[model samples]
Each structure stands twice: as structure tokens, then as C-alpha cells.
Target: MLLAILLPFLSFMIRGKIITGIICLILQFTLIGWLPAAIWAALSLQNARAEKRNEKLIRAIKENSK
Candidate 1:
């Protein structure tokens, strides 16, 4: 819940995606763009998490195979 509120800032600070953050910030200033920006941020975060999980799983699989 709290994360959803600050998604744009978190996207920039934690994920280091300047462009995403900037886009979110710009969208926040507009009437229609706010929701889209938030959705985009959430998706970006989800994708990042999924990528990390996949990387960890691959590493684990390699270790197990060895």
C-alpha cells in the first residue's frame, strides 16, 4: 500500500531507472497520466523482481548440477 503511493520515487531510488522515474513524475503532474504512471512503475518493479528471481534460480540450478 505504502509502496504503491511512492512507486515513482522507489522506482528511481531503488531500481535506479531514471527514465522510468522521470516519466512517472511527469505523468503525476498530468490528470490522465497519474494512473498509467503508477501502473508502469508497478510493472517495472515486478519485472525487476522476476528477473532477479530467475537469475537466482539459474544460479541454484547450475550449482546443483555441479
Candidate 2:
């Protein structure tokens, strides 16, 4: 989350979204776009975490059904 706020472009690259990272880098270059880019990065990070949690829950459900 902090990484998303501090370095939004790098955060997207770290998450394997290179194209998005490049676009974010361009947004970061402009003072007006930085806030929106950081918000987008933070939301993306949150979504990734939620997806991971959902996957783990699904796996656990499958194991218990066995």
C-alpha cells in the first residue's frame, strides 16, 4: 500500500503489469496525474490481495469437501 502511494509505477511493475506500469510512469511524470495514479495503484494492490484471499478460501473449501 505504501509502495503504491510512494512509487505507483514500480508497484504495478512489481505486480507484473508492465504495460500499466509504463502508463503509470507517464502519469507520474505530470504533477496533476500523480494523485490519481497513486489511487489507482493502491486500489489495484487491494484488488490483488482480495483475489489471493478468495483463491485461498476456494482451495480450503475444495479440500474440506474431499
Quick one: best TM-score, which candidate? 2
Q: What lDDT is reached at residue 30 by model 1?
A: 82
Off by over 4 Å in 2: none
- Alpha-carbon RMSD, candidate 1: 1.9
Looking at model 2, residue 22 earns an lDDT score of 100
Q: What are the per-model numbers of colliding residue pairs?
A: 0, 0
| Residues 1-66 of candidate 1: C-alpha lDDT, one tens digit per residue | 357455565665566777767767888888687777777777777888799999999999999999
The lDDT, on a scale of 0 to 1, for candidate 1 is 0.73
Q: Write one digit per residue (lDDT tens) for candidate 2, span 1-66.
A: 899999999999999999999999999999999999999999999999999999999999999999
Clashes of 1: 0
Residue 57, candidate 1: C-alpha displacement in angstroms: 0.3
Using lDDT as the measure, the top candidate is 2
Model 1 Cα shift for residue 10 (angstroms): 4.1
